[model samples]
Target: MTKFKKRPSKLKKFLGLLGPGLVTGASDDDPSGIATYSQAGAQFGLATLWLALLTFPLMAAIQGMCARIGLVTSQGLTVTLKNHYSKPLLYIMLLFSFPAITLNIGADIQGMGAVAHMIIPAIPVSVFCVAFTAILMFIIIKYPYQKIAKILKWLCLSLLLYMIVPFMIKQDWVLVVKNTFIPTIHFNKEFFSIVVAILGTTISPYLFFWQATMEVENMAQSKRKIIVNKRVLGDMRTDVNTGMVLSNLVMFFIILTTGSVLYNSGIRQIDTVDQAAKALEPLTGKLTYLIFAIGVLGTGLLAIPVLAGSQSYMLAETFGWEAGLDKKFPQAKAFYISIIISLLVGLSLDFLGISPIKALLFTAITYGLTAPILIAIILHIGNNKEIMGENTNSKFSNVLGFITLFIMTVAAVALIYFLFK
Candidate 1:
């Protein structure tokens, strides 16, 4: 007699739906992003909270297109770009991406180090940075893709602390709700710069690369030669949507918590995660500070790997070296080396005497400058029939993609104007 196969339970199935999208989304809230969002909250109050809502659809569309590209083509974005675009253009894009990603990694490692030092005063920040770099490199080199993804997914739970913190403090629900739904525009230079930073950090370039490659990784894990089935596509949509929602929800709460506590308490500037945490102690108690610190550390762990990995993947693909987190160190020496170099360079930034929060903000500004160029390329690829085939972006996707591009372009132009003026 033939035996019946056991079906997965609802919870099991729901968990199964998550993959690269979830991990990518979680990584989006990295230390730098936390710094940017926290700065926005502390500096501007609830005026910027609506950005979390506004960016959700735009981010989902762009990332969904990226996921579709990987699933359909069975390649990372860099490989696809190399195949279609000129060698000169590819090199130029890589040149822009490398430094931006490097600065981001450096800032993130520095942020993590600062937080580590905050938690343990006796240990120096340099030691923590070195330790974090070593620990993350070991995990990426030793763990298989599935295990790494699982660990990252669990780390995302730390962001729930942001959601919980908001409820612990009294809030002006009327003002919060009003500001969240209604857009608030400030013509000031500082506001414009922060808006650009918020947009840049949220819909980041690293995430673009990570999301696409991750879909490719997931396809490999499934042992599928091609992604042609409607069911498979549907599952991907579910995963991407779920991940983006969770990412933005965490962003929303972070802004809300800081706006209610830090901004209201007259702490208008947040130079470190420590300052943000300490300012919360009097208002939300010690637990709030602990949770914020943990959230920053957790997100840093989740994000630094992605930052390093995205660079490795793009470089490996561009240079025709074997790449994938699934491969052993011996099998993918270049890829592994790329990761090590990124982490070490980032770790060194901690000793540069630059303020962690300032470095983090500067990285966001760099991303803001580079992200639009990458987004434009993504849109072009998503709409190219030869590249995406029937999976080409729908009208709705195209509309949202262009809107996102336009918004970023305007922000960039506005930023330049403010700088010159």
Candidate 2:
């Protein structure tokens, strides 16, 4: 008998819908972001929960535009900029992006190492840091795009562990609900700095590059002639929005966890993910701490590849070198070499005596300063009829993108002002 193809189950369809956006979104809540959110909650209690509501739409809009840019252009953001924009702008992005992404990788590696040390006092943090660097390097070189993408998708589940932590302890549901809906503002340098950190960390520049490049890579690997059409864009939008929502939900639960467990007990000032995990052990016991620590490590594995890969992709595109996760090391030697160098440099930060907390804060500031400019460029690229053709930014997207630009501009200024003030 002639057989009909078995239809994919809804679960499989949903999973299929998830790709670059989901991984990018989940990676956004990397170890450094965890530190930022944990600090906000520990220091200010539930005051910042409402910010999650505000950022979700903004992040989705920007990431969606980026994915669209990649889809319509069939090229990474860097290539588009290189072809259309000025060389000065492209080089400047590279300069800031390299350090910003490298520092981010360093901080994540350190955070994961410290958390591992906490779990096993016998292992030295430096050793763990080096070991992680080696393992990550091997995986990037060993795996092609599909394998790496699959691994990243699976690692996204580690974020759910944070969701579990809040339920493990008794929480004031009413207080959490009140804080979720109510916006709280404290007018001070410290408060505004944390606000900027959250903004900068969530609406990051590297993820924009990574998202677009990933879409291009995804398309390149497919055997089918991927056309950029309404249905395709719709799927892309679904993926990006789903990722943004997942990322912010993890942020919400993390804030809730630290706000309830640490803030209520009179502890505050969580500067690092390891510190946040350590702080939880005494109060919420070892299990919650273990979950949080493991999540940190998982986020590092998910995020570092993104951090390093985006940096390398930026360089690859800028220099016209071969690139893509799909290319084997021999096929993309420079690409893999850059990844190795980034990981090594990041690992060296710990051994070089640079503090991870400072690295993370600097990384945030770097991103804060650079993000607004990149957003403006993305807006222009998205709207340029020659570049995007029929896939230009919609009115709603333009509105959200402009709002994000305005907010990020104000936040960037505030972050700098606070630094000098």
lDDT of each: 0.87, 0.93
- Lowest summed lDDT across 10 adjacent residues in model 1 is found at 223-232
lDDT agreement of model 2 with the native? 0.93
The collision pairs in model 2 are none
Model 2 agreement with the true structure over 152-187: per-residue lDDT tens digits: 999999999998999999989998889889889887
Q: Provide TM-scores for the models.
A: 0.97, 0.98
Clashes of each: 0, 0
Model 2, residue 319: C-alpha shift (Å): 0.7
Q: lDDT of candidate 1?
A: 0.87
In candidate 2, position 224 carries an lDDT of 94
